[model samples]
Target: MTSMMAPNAAGLSDADIANLAAHIASFGGAAAAPAAEAPAAEAAAAPAAAAGDVAAGKAKFAACAACHGMNGEGQGMFPKVAGQSADVLADKLKKYRAGETVGPMSAMMAPNASGLSDADIADLSAYMASL
Candidate 1:
């Protein structure tokens, strides 16, 4: 597992982490954590929310393709978003919007998030999760 506390260069957050844990759980595995802390466990056990529009998400994802790649496989410094949960992706974006995360890598993503509406975020999240 990658560092979850590295200033979230990808702008991930507690909710995002939880969503990721839930996403992975759907496949019968859990996201790794340093310890089975309450927050981490709770995140891992949380149910996924029904949000995002796959079609709209596909459109929004076009903007992310540059970094996340066409198939969400990622390239260069970018990480994989394919198969990641929409909740996770949304939460990460929320962190970026909230200024809870940042870095040179994240800086690039920061501006991309601009002009995104909540529905856009949900759709993009759904699309990424579908990938």
Candidate 2:
């Protein structure tokens, strides 16, 4: 974590990391079971389970199926969203909606996210994670 979290990147201090760690520990830490659920090729392709509703998220994901594939199996430049971290998904959506560029696809994603409210992003993130 120290090596990957460069200063000014995510704005986290050493204390902040410690606090986050404690928070995670409070919940018994991350489970190792999820990684084992998939095969070697997708061992690390797990998803995040945030405080969003999976059912609602599923309904909201329909519109995203066109480009993200029916099951969120992204192809080419469209990165896979299925089994992705909820935090990561929500973060990207929020960033895109705010007109912040996170990558080459920002131009296309930004407009798509512009009209999305926080609820929509959460629902979408939850839905994608479940995939």
Candidate 3:
């Protein structure tokens, strides 16, 4: 008797093939993973500075201008961040700093946000919101 196997079988178990098929199907042929959630503690942490300085935020934003534009109008695939709420921006930054994949750009943002403190997030958020 001959054992029937899948045509593309290359040491992968039937279950493994099924799982791979499911994953591929979920993305409609694209291989994107779902966004990760932020840790509860990190998500709950309040902004370090009570009031953010727009000047400081502007200074800090110099690094962000390359992709976001000097006026915060995002270029190409980059999303526009200007006019976002301070709280929302801070939360997203905190999530990025914690290495959570909040969006498609999380990989790029994680490195940039890693060095920011809560105070820095506040300042940056304030500046971005002002725009």
Candidate 4:
């Protein structure tokens, strides 16, 4: 079998790092990257948020209130989502939908995120960030 280095071990080109930074910035988050292969980590977390309707996002968020609370404050064991950048929220939801484990809540979140379309993600992210 061919040996594969870890993404960090392999490192990233300058162009790749710049692209990752741009992607993060588009999501309204600060562009931060290590001097090494930081692009791998950033790329994994980066997802673009499409334009969304805040009103609709609010309506959609009601379904999430059971765990996240009406204001996205999050209840016990459900981490706070309010004020998170749109890109972060969208990327996390996307990962959950794809059944990729992100944290302790991965199993619980998978089902909730499974049915979300890109538009849904965008709307939800917008709503959560506005909180």
Give residue 22's error in model 3 in angstroms: 46
- For all candidates in order, the CA lDDT equals 0.62, 0.67, 0.71, 0.69
Model 3 Cα lDDT, one tens digit per residue, 36-114: 5656786567443347787888878866765677788887777798998888888788788788999998987886777
For model 2, residues 33-76, the per-residue Cα lDDT tens digits are 21122353542453333567888878667556545766999755
Candidate 4 — which pairs collide?
A: none
**Per-residue lDDT for 19-92 in model 1, tens only?**
55554344333322222223656655653225577887786565576457778898767889888877778767
Q: Tell me the spans in candidate 2 whose CA falls farther than 4 Å from its real position.
A: 1-49
What are the TM-scores, per candidate, against the unseen true structure? 0.59, 0.61, 0.63, 0.64
Backbone clash pairs for candidate 3 read none
The TM-score of candidate 2 is 0.61
Which scores greater on TM-score, model 2 or model 4? 4
- Measured over all alpha carbons after superposition, the RMSD of each candidate to the real structure, in angstroms, is 14.6, 14.9, 16.3, 17.0
Please give the lDDT score at residue 74 for candidate 4.
73
The C-alpha local distance difference test score for the whole of candidate 3 amounts to 0.71
Ranking according to lDDT, highest score first: 3, 4, 2, 1
TM-score of 1: 0.59
> In candidate 4, how many Å is residue 103 off?
0.4
What's each prediction's clash count?
3, 0, 0, 0
